[model samples]
Target: MIKIETPLTIDKVKCLKAGDEVLITGTMYTLRDAGHMRVIEQINKDEKLPFDMKNSIIYYVGPSPAKLGAVIGSAGPTTSYRMDEFTPALLELGLKGMIGKGARNKEVIQSMVKNTAVYFGAVGGAAALLASCIKSSEIIAYEDLGPEALRKLYVEDFPVIVVIDSLGKNIYEIEKEKYKIVE
Candidate 1:
């Protein structure tokens, strides 16, 4: 497995390839659908964002409330497609990477290529394991959204796979082709 850290620069993003396992260590933002919408709204209104987008990675998760003594709970990745419509705009604004589960749409892939970004896939069934990697979590914005509120997370060795590389190589498409049944 490859080891990577954030804030991810174009150099770091370009070095990754689809299908490579990675253990990421550093800061990442957590936001679900409602938080994404709120961010877009802020951008449209020309308001400053709560965090810097440049060279940053956002994780798509709405973690469950922590049971006393835990940093976060059940922090599994959410389906990425739900955020596809908002992704290109964020990519345009220098967002460099995203961690989630499932395939993204064509437009999202195209945007990643255009902006030199990457998409990582976190295992879906390993919520507790993922939460263990989070060293700290602080709500950053949209607190009214509760679990969907934006959070800044400090992580260490958070596991993921490069689902889509900056050059547009996609593991989902590659794997499908690799195992396709001959007609």
Candidate 2:
């Protein structure tokens, strides 16, 4: 497995390819649909985002309320397709990577290639296991959105698969083709 660090640089992302297994370490931001909308609004108003976008990664999740003495609750990836509407905009702002489950739309995939970005697939239904990788997390913006708020997270050895690479190559497409039953 390739070990990657946060604030991923263009060179680093370029080296990654679809179908590689990777472990990401360092900080990543969290945003659900509400937070995503806010990002677009912030950009339209020329307002600075809650976190710097350059070379940053965002994880799509709305973690459950933490239990006492826990840093986070069951934290799993949300479906990536839901974020497709705002993904191109985020990528244009130098967002280097994203972590979520499922396939993205064509426009979003094209944007990744144009922006030298990558998309990672976190295993679905692995919430409790994945939550352990989060060392710390805090609300960074849109707290009123509750679980849909934007958050800053410090993670270590977070496991993910390269679903889409900077070249617009896609693991989803490859796997689908491989499994196709030729009649």
Candidate 3:
């Protein structure tokens, strides 16, 4: 498995390819649809964001309440396409990587290619296992949104796969072709 860290640089992003297993380390943010909407609204208003966007990774998640003595709980990836409408704008703002499940839309893929970014796929049913990778977590913004609040996470060796690479090569497409039954 390839090991990577944030904030991801352009060179690092470009070097990755679809279908590569990766263990991501360092910092990332957690945000679901509500958080995403708030961020885009702030951008539209020309207000400063709570966190820096450059080279940053955002995981599409709304973590469960922590269990006793745990940093986070059941932090599974949410379906990514829910945030697709706001993705391109975030990519344009220099967001380098995203972590979630499933395919992105055409516009988001185009934006990723243009912005030198990547998309990671986290296993959907592996929430508890994924939470163990998170070393620390803190609510950074939108606390009123509760579980949907934006969070700053310090992770170590968090597991993911390069579902879509910077060049727009998609693991979903490749795997579909590879496993397709001949008619």
Candidate 4:
């Protein structure tokens, strides 16, 4: 039942333990499958990334289309495991935090431990609820991709659980074991 007050940096984030709930403020960027692919291409070529990676959180999301007179439409986290291929490279670039649902791979967790990163899980099926926390959204890169566009999202008090910590502790592992129905 630990709570982490955010505007979090890598140092503060590395200290987070499993079972900690975080309230994230400041800014986050949204990038899903297409966006991740492009970033990885850039990384392989030793090209510069679109934004500062230090202490930043990347949300794995492809939001619902925006409705009329709305900042964004129903927005929520997508499955995170799909981004595993691209994540280690991004982590090497100093990317510290991720927000999404579900579990990541062994490599991703190992990279997090080596790099002192954290993974957070936002609630699933709460698209409309998640949208309320997003203050503004704009495409920062890869605009041709539509909803999969790389977006810089300004958010306040965004809620998430500390899924995996820098120390290699994972909430998903604990929860799975706790709830596993033995046959």
Q: Please provide, for model 2 over 3-26, each residue's C-alpha lDDT reduced to its tens digit, 9 standing for 90 to 100.
A: 999879999999999999999999
Backbone clashes, each candidate: 0, 0, 0, 0
Native-to-model Cα distance after best TM-score fit, residue 121 in candidate 2, in Å = 0.4
Candidate 1 stretches with Cα past 4 Å from truth are none
Error of 3 at 7 (Å): 1.3
Model 3 Cα RMSD, 1 decimal: 0.8
| Candidate 2, superposed: residue stretches over 4 Å from native | none
lDDT of 1 by residue, 23-80 (tens): 9999999988999999999999999999999999999999999999989989999999
**Candidate number with greatest lDDT:** 1
lDDT, candidate 2, equals: 0.94
Residue 38 displacement (Å), model 4: 0.4
Q: Please report, in order, the local distance difference test score of every candidate based on alpha carbons.
A: 0.96, 0.94, 0.95, 0.87
lDDT of 3 by residue, 1-183 (tens): 999878899999988999999999999999999999999999999999999999999999999999899899899999999999999999999999999999899999999999999999999989999999999999989999999999999999999999999999999998998899998
In the predicted model 3, the residue pairs found to clash are none
Query: Over the stretch 58-78, how does candidate 4's per-residue lDDT look in tens digits?
Result: 999888888887889888899
**TM-scores for every predicted model:** 0.97, 0.97, 0.98, 0.93
